[model samples]
Target: MSIEREDLMICPARVTLDAAQMAFFDGLPTKAPSVQAELGCELEQGHEGSHAALGQQVDTTMWWIQWTLSASEINPYTWCPATHLPDTERRDDKDCALFNGHPGSHSSAKRSWQASEAA
Candidate 1:
């Protein structure tokens, strides 16, 4: 009962990262890390910048499809924007380190590192 994902639809959202963030990302390793990536994510693509630059986003639960989008393609509106939730009473004041519109659960919802928690 497994579906073939080779033909699944993908999200096409693309945005520009702000100058500071883009500059920071450009400094990270693109294919291999000559320096420590400093990221603390647990996903296979979460290790280093070089690895991430070459990896594509792969979560199916998000309202936006990102299986075909590259990690390099995502540029959040801002860090810890907290604009995704519709709830008025969650009362979670902890901010996520990942950018807005990131895939998977927010960092505030979990203690460990996640796919989009990279800075």
Candidate 2:
């Protein structure tokens, strides 16, 4: 997915929401997506030495039941901060959604643009 200019501000370090804000997540409607299990994790170097940031990586599996929870009958997909996104690009193949709608684009295009080595 293309990273919007606003996405540059997205950081996991700044935890703005308070405990009360997350209290409702526990009561998320039955249809709400659930993190039933954490299959595994792949850690990468963080900006600081010896510290790693946790972002979804290959071999890390999360099972979710798609659901639309509402507040005052309004779906809050826009306000929900925990939107799911893959941390790394895998491939353009069907098995991978790195290029789900961009058929002709090379899977390594982003990597080349970013000038980073593959994981």
Candidate 3:
């Protein structure tokens, strides 16, 4: 089964899943009675599947994407920039992005996060 590349999480890191691995990911269900479809993360530096649960849960601590990346060729780690004020000089209190109270960091002090490594 070939999954749409656009449907993947919008992360810069390499999605190194091979055909077989992709087949496995494609075959897995995104939702269950308790689990919901994990939407792709839009944050510039957020980790893949950070915005949603992309894969089924393998256990209490990890999900299927995590399992797949363990063997795939990706960066050593994924550290996304917390949401920051687009203009830190002014009194702008709103986040640069529309999302608020999201996961990861949202500290007003942070002006930006790590520079993107790849497209």
Candidate 4:
């Protein structure tokens, strides 16, 4: 099965996942559930500073949400494999995509969790 590429989004708040959010993530795959159940999740913080490359000075701001997911949970969301951007089929949130997919693919609880997340 192929996950879509647009549903993933790096949460901007850099906040920890709430109970509902945690529940949502728990239904993705065995790997994701296990990881969420264990280490939990954390939104990523961006790097701050300047660097020189090729004799040119440049500045950059990076952003992402990082969580200790299992090997199987890696790239579980629908995202551009290369760019990591939301793709055409990607859901607005990971939970939506997770529950929307077949139970054979993952878990069924995520869909209900996503509904709560959206409200």
Candidate 5:
């Protein structure tokens, strides 16, 4: 089945960077803006608390970045090829409202846990 891009609601893709990469990204003050302009979407920096769960202490100094996607730019099914078919189909039915008020859903909990353990 083919899906129309404009009919899909897209969410931001969050990425966690290692210390070195974070440093590079931060070193260039205009990096975020440049990326945002090129992608035609917001590229935001997430806070530490958003990186880990409440009351959790993390050791590694990782930085979080989010790339906001527009409905015309992403098709959940195509973007997340490994995601279950049901989930891909659900995005359209739900109008991508699934992430409302759910910051935890976007948090890099797994990455934080792994980084902390590695430290």
Candidate 6:
């Protein structure tokens, strides 16, 4: 049976990297062509800083990467392989959203809802 777009749910997958893995990722070529080809999606990476309060332990900086998943890669019955990091452990799933419509596309449902509210 075919599944509709709105019926699908997306979630994020995390990969915690060690020192060596982090170095390898940092040394990757600009634009990360090889990594992108392997993952089948565009990627954007950045460093996320952490803050601590008094008497609390300071959090270490981590490399944060986000990517978009292809339609075929999404599986409602199982967890989708969102990101494939080199030699890292998996973590809990994070909430994700999927937008099917293209930019500037008209939304008939939105219009209908507006009309109903006006009545």
Top lDDT prediction, candidate number? 3
- Candidate 2 per-residue lDDT, tens place, 20-59, comes to 3334344554332322222111111122211111111222
Candidate 1: tens digits of C-alpha lDDT, residues 36-99: 2232232132322311111111221111111223543332234445634664332232544344
The TM-scores of all predictions, comma-separated, are 0.26, 0.20, 0.24, 0.22, 0.19, 0.20
lDDT of 5 by residue, 28-54 (tens): 433122122122111123322222111
Give stretches of model 2 more than 4 Å off.
1-13, 30-75, 78-119
Instruction: Tell me model 1's lDDT, rounded to 2 decimals.
Output: 0.32
Give me candidate 1's TM-score against the actual structure. 0.26
List candidate 4 segments past 4 Å from native: 1-13, 33-77, 81-119
Q: Number of the top candidate by TM-score?
A: 1
From the highest lDDT down, the ranking of the candidates is 3, 1, 5, 4, 6, 2
Model 3 local distance difference test score: 0.33
In candidate 3, what are the lDDT values of residues 1-119, reduced to their tens digit? 87544334334443334566456545545332232233233333464343322233222212333323444321222222233544343223243321333354332321121111110
TM-score of decoy 2: 0.20
lDDT score, candidate 2, position 106: 18
lDDT computed for candidate 2? 0.24
List lDDT for all candidates, in order. 0.32, 0.24, 0.33, 0.26, 0.27, 0.25
Clashing pairs in 6: none
Worst 10 residues of 3 by lDDT: 110-119
* Residue pairs clashing, model 3: 38-53
Stretches off by above 4 angstroms in model 1 are: 1-35, 38-77, 83-93, 109-119
C-alpha RMSD by candidate, in order? 12.7, 15.1, 13.6, 16.8, 14.4, 19.9
List clashing residue pairs in candidate 4: 4-78, 5-78, 5-79, 5-87, 6-86, 6-87, 6-90, 7-90, 7-91
lDDT of 5 at 46: 35
Local accuracy of candidate 4 as per-residue lDDT tens digits, 1-119: 76533213212232244465455445433221122323322211232221100110012111112333222122222311222234524223332232111122221112333234334
The regions of model 5 sitting more than 4 angstroms off are 1-59, 70-102, 106-119
